[model samples]
Target: MAAALGVLRRSDEGQSLSGAVLLAAHDLLYEQVPFPLGESSLCRLAELLVGRGVVPKSSDYEGRWYLWWPKSGRGPCRDCGKSRSLTRFSGRFGDDYRYLCARCRATERHVIAERVEQLHAMPGVQAAHSAWVCGPGPTGTRSAGGTEAEIPSAQEWSEYATRLHEMLSPLEWAGFELPEEWDTDFDRRHGGLLFETLWRGDGGVGVSYHPHEGKVVLGPFDDVAGQWPHSYSLLEDSLEIPVPGSGRQAAAAVEVAAGQAGLLDATHVYVAESAPEEARQEFTTHRIRRIFQPAAEFRRLPLNELLRETTEDHWLSSYLDWVVGRAGQDVAPDIVPDAAALGVAAWCWRNNTAVEAHHLETDVLMARVNIAVTRLTRQYICPVEGIDWDSIKDALMDPGWALPDTTPIHSLFGEGWTEVAATVCAELDRWRRLDHERLGAQTTLILMTIGGSTGYTDSWWGQGRWHSICRHILDEAIAAGLTLPAPYDRNGPEAFLADLHTPDRLSDAALDWIIDLRGAAFEGPRGLRMNRITRPPRHCWDPFWHSSTGV
Candidate 1:
């Protein structure tokens, strides 16, 4: 073919891009039995096709090549858009058959261009060399490198003092000019405020607030070395911290983040030492108040016994420090000899009853120790690995899909989980076999996921909208399943009319206990979650909920 095209010198008339030429070219490409052609021969064929007026030029054959390559053939390039695509069709019947296209074959890496400028009249003296990461490459992957590439990428600094602030407002907190002494190892060595989070740095590795290549970019890699690492997001994949409000709200934000991350303990607890005493006490008590009683102001609750059980490195140690010694200290109370201590004793011992009947001789330290243990174990234990807890929970739900662990505390005393497992297996067998039960569970999952809720909500709810949150609580009796629609309130807004009956009887406390089972899966009760998000956006109904009514 090259010989034939070579015999005919470049013809000014070439070939008119006519129907006959297109018909001939199409037939040559698609109609004939597939056959082999050498690279040299292929170029000649392109020239021949050009001479026959199929394509008018060869200077940029690619511009038109893409328009025609979809000739349904025996072998086609699978990865066309990728850099290392295999669009090569050798055309041989059996030996070489993969095909690659012009665009992918033309892909190239960015070249770092360099231009040297000699200094003084002095021999061999050098001023500097300008360098930049020249583009026409894949994307904004590599940093604009080289010492002389002075075009600062508006990404090297943040205005906020902490990583927490930078994340909330990345736009306002964007890049600032460097101090210009950045040539040494200093940038990577310190990793302090300039580019890193003030206090969020964990063992010198902090996250880059900027998203890069759809990955969680990590590093302070020596800019000179120019190598950085990226991982999927958790803290980098397994956990994601929400863009909670700036500064002081970090603790509250992390409280939600930790549970969502399925973590054993809160990973990032940001309460500045300079925070107020009231704030510190509030932070400490907020945790205790979630599961324990006396949600308001209290001097302290005991921690010494729990402290003895724990070591210095325990995850709770630093948090416990704030309220540790404060417990056991005496405060005055009327009519009782040591009523101040009694109040502390009350939080540790009170489980369900409204009454406080511990003896005057009640061991407050032991009682407080028990409370501390329950706080950590029952309420905040990490999500257990390999447990299809949802399945177990489904088995426990009554037909109404009530919350589990609703039994009086005493009822949970003697039975082991083995019996529960048997019941769960039986229940799951029953639920899965029933089409409505299975589909209802799936449909309930869909409603909860009005937006992405999967990661934060258990696969269950991450990938869900940031606003949509689901928390799973586990109770002993009430196996929280799909939320039946809230019972119609005769006195509700819908029932608003002139002649109203007395207000609906359920008090706020009663409503709390009643709704507590709505999303119970395996452990402690996480309180009501709505716009306020009190208990870390709590509860995902059993995957199988017969939602006859609205939630």
Candidate 2:
């Protein structure tokens, strides 16, 4: 009871104790109790604690009890109206809590970049072709006076040419030709151009390009709009215009620059009825013929589909089909082959890490044990007398029999509560160790048959931008009441807590742990039925994360 209250009292958001909050609270009490205590059971324990006055409840108005933390005097931020606990920068932003959340700050930066793009596209600022790198801003390098540093080497054209070439190289795959005049102008003008990227405490991004010796210096619209002028003529002057896609093709973008350079075949250009006025006008200016095609048809074909279709007799596809069949569903498109691929890839990646063979074997077992516990607690609840032990053995060996439920246990058996709990506990522990042994003996070579660890690990999970994403995923799952199994070994607690504070480590380790848990848990006769399963999304293939060489 005191343990539960200690957790609740530690919350920065002490308004409501959710399942995640309860789990996090329970984790915070690791020193007092080491075993895995389920969140529902802990909630029940909290009820007992509050009613007995062992842990005083601050309020019961929100359908659940809440305890206020003395230091949790935080509320909505004054600027962004977001609930934040810590103040990022204090007096500079009036009040510290008045500052923006990480996301809002990030958006502000993107907006700044966008505003800069709009400013550069104006007629007066002559960069020829300037684009705002969308999404989040990089950590800006600042001068001693706190202003952003200038783009050094105005006399060095080679450096600028290399950078321009690097950025433009990826577009070559779209089957377009670059104008000789455009390339020449880019090379000649590279040295005399100043590329300035500015950043604000609220994460606002502002980028500008001007002649190295030119008088015009553009910045954030609000900061320099009065002195600066907007030129509508430049909108039509730029060669390459990148249009962000929408709907099913949200992560893809179409570069309309080639048409302006006379590289687009008029017969190949088609504008849909849904194409915006701007796109239509641009298409018209380029003398491109229009055919109405659905936006869905314009989407880039998925790389996975292309690869899978091209590779004849791919062992990976065959394995996926087998796994899907085992899951009680026919191997079909709706099952998301990518999810299975990612799960297998993550497993292989973890195997390559320095973790010893013994530990790896133990982790696999613990994962199975976790599944058993969840099944016993949630799926197979029944009294000792009512549960068919022989049926359980048969079910474990075969996939047909249903696990026992709580109703049968209570209705059929009135006594032996302690004995029932003990019996199941022993059985789960035994299976947990055996499953570990079973998995340790299996080959990890199947992972190599897929895209291997390269696509799954290096792209998303390995990237710094995706560092906090695992925490986001976990938080989402916990909020949705998805319970994970407890650690099977004594050392399991530390492994679970490893990298909890570091986002990258947390993400990598969390993915490894979750996959291991799912692989073992779902390995039962009823395969992969859990709704709240974690997997990488198609957006993970966003071009923003990639350069010419790839992420």
Candidate 3:
């Protein structure tokens, strides 16, 4: 048996078969040497071994490997029951060990193609053209999916040109034409003029012309009336007439007056032939008023003209007051509780006192009392609604003053004012803990909310003006010869407190820190009223510092 085993290992065919079987079953244990193999070579080896009666084979088992043949032809094919011919089948690899037929591979490819087709059918995928996908051509190339590119055809370009002309036709109808003397090719060369639509409330469309580089712009009007005199004119038949009169006049006359007041050196003028001198004078007066006074001031002028007349609801009156004056006594009464709470919060912030929950409640009450006095002083200003007074007072008394409520006053205080104050205070506290390097970034965010930043352009809180005030305060503080504290990596609250009292360099870094403190003080619940009247004795700290000193 040993000599036969050695002979089987030495034969070329026997050696090749043994090597292939061993490679296939390398992981199998020697005790499990009779395990099945499915490859063709393994079947040939099985035939060789069986011819020598090394393993049993049934008469029904033909070219099957000995490992795959059951002793009684009873067990399922030792390779797998699915294998019909042991010589024809081989095991396939998968996520888990499984026997796969050739048929399953073909099905996977079909499913992938169907999904790709569905994705291409989505909306806008075909409608939106990208130049990258459609390479440049005289007429842009179409996409692989057969969608036309955005490249415009000659006919389409002509139609777009026609539409542009149609849009501008009304301006031509109104005696305003694109400067005809210039080249027809000017638009092509200069990328065309930017056309802006001017809408009239009276259901008219007007066109305004701005030249490529010219300063003078012209707009045509049906009537010049009370609008800017220097900028508008009414065309007459072949002659230019200046509108006549003063004080109260026709629209054309007012235009002339406005033009004259503006001292415009008119190279051209359009005038109405039938305008009365009174109309002309009024036009000029309105123009003068507009030219000399600011928009807010001009709007508030107590003129009884139709155009200058105030609204019935006193909207303009309230708006002007809100813009130009401090919060009126009546306005304060409406939001007194919120304003008071904010004041108390500001007080606590400036003094470095903990803004505990109880303090917020007590300060709110105090704010209400103060607001009530202001409201009473302005009692004659407007009729006091009984509910308005009671609601405000009750809201102030309530511990949950900052909580959301359905009433308008509650909405304003609980939602608006409280939110702004809370955000400001929180931001201030956040920066107080940051190191000096992050001070500027935090200060910019805080000032942005308070209108202290450059974005405060609307004149809404007098923010631009306040920014100037803040700059001046910083300048004074820096000029006082203060020294900066040594830089630390991670300074905490105690370090912040120490820096506040210590003298510091008045660089952008120092200014940002001081501005934050001042901004917090300004936004604090109590309003600071500086007495500009009294002159402080020598050795006085800056009034701003003293006023903001919390006490």
Judge candidate 1 against the unseen true structure and give its global Cα lDDT, from 0 to 1.
0.26
Model 1 ranges off by over 4 Å: 1-156, 160-206, 211-255, 262-355, 358-470, 474-481, 484-551
List the global CA lDDT of all models: 0.26, 0.29, 0.28
Model with the higher TM-score, candidate 2 or 3: 2
Estimate, for each residue in 1-551, the C-alpha lDDT of model 2 and write its tens digit.
Answer: 46666655554344554445554454455335443434444454444332222322223223122322111123344446655431222111111212344345435434544444464457844232221122111221132223343444422333233222223222222211212111222232222343332221111112222222211122321323322211111111232222221111111212123212211111111234554555445434322111111111223334344334424535434533443223212111111112222322233212332222223234333333223322332222111111222334333333222222222321221244334334444443433332233211011111111222233232222222122333444444445444543441343433443443232223333435444334343433111122222222210001122233422
lDDT of 3 by residue, 1-551 (tens): 23333334555453544434443332232223433432333444344443322333222233233344222111123333442211211221112112222223223223423332343245664333222211121222333234432344443333223222223332322222222112122232222222332321111223321121211122333333434322332221111222111111212232332232211111112123344455445434543343223323324443344124423425333422442122221110111121222222232232223223223333333233233322322221111010122233334434444422222322334434464445435534443332122212212112111111111111111111222233333344334433322241244333433343322222334333443333233433111123111111111001121112232
**Separate clash counts for every candidate:** 51, 3, 20
The Cα error of candidate 1 at residue 242, in Å, is 7.6
TM-score: model 1 vs. ground truth: 0.21
Error of model 1, residue 149, in angstroms: 14
Candidate with top TM-score is: 1
In model 3, the number of clashes is 20
What lDDT is reached at residue 232 by model 2? 12
RMSD after Cα superposition, model 2: 28.3
